[model samples]
Target: MHIEDHPVLGKQLQAPVKFYFNGQEYKAYKQQTVAAALIANGIKKFGLSRKLVQSRGLFCSRGRCCSCYMTVNGEDHVRTCMTRIDEGMIVSPNLEDPVIRSDRDGD
Candidate 1:
């Protein structure tokens, strides 16, 4: 099955919104959350394990959960699931470091 037109989100979406991940450009809809936008761009894992350094990504849809949390605009620990995106926003990894593993690649 496929979505011909979304009933809740509407068929005609707003202008394509642009944001950056690891300094790379990408587009998303104006109505989408940061997490949604990232997911649309094929981002599977958005975070790393606190200790083990395993990959992490969104599990819960609501902001009450910290699963989608990441750094936005250089601020630490912002919830991507709660933040609605705007044009030309910049998103980057927020790893706790003194050391970055080879997995420091973008989502």
Candidate 2:
């Protein structure tokens, strides 16, 4: 879902970088976001919801929405849309919602 040739920007010049999605090797541009890269690879479903288990993907390409949350590089609850792709990076679905901690709970 990307413009191959922009009327103004023209052709893309970014080199491809290797990355892993749930243990499966995939390719993406160096400057592309994890979500955009995944979408470019024809991956529509990012993960399932915690309560309903409904499929979720890039609803708001912007980082304001949480629909694109996933695990990246051994970290939980990463917003894939806002994360840039890096070589050898690992991305995975957060199947279950992570526990949220509040400062008052520890006090």
Encode model 2's per-residue lDDT on 1-107: one tens digit a residue.
55567799887836888999878998788878999989988887899998898999999989999899999997788999999999999999878866677564583
Query: Whole-model lDDT for model 2 versus the true structure?
Result: 0.86
Among these predictions, the greatest lDDT belongs to: 2
Whole-model lDDT values for every prediction: 0.76, 0.86
RMSD in angstroms, all models? 7.1, 3.7
Clash totals for all candidate models = 0, 0
Given candidate 1, what's the lDDT at residue 89? Answer: 89
Which candidate number maximizes TM-score?
2
By summed lDDT, which 10 consecutive residues of candidate 1 come out lowest? 98-107
Spell out the clash pairs found in candidate 2. Answer: none
Task: Give stretches of model 1 more than 4 Å off.
Answer: 1-4, 7-9, 97-107
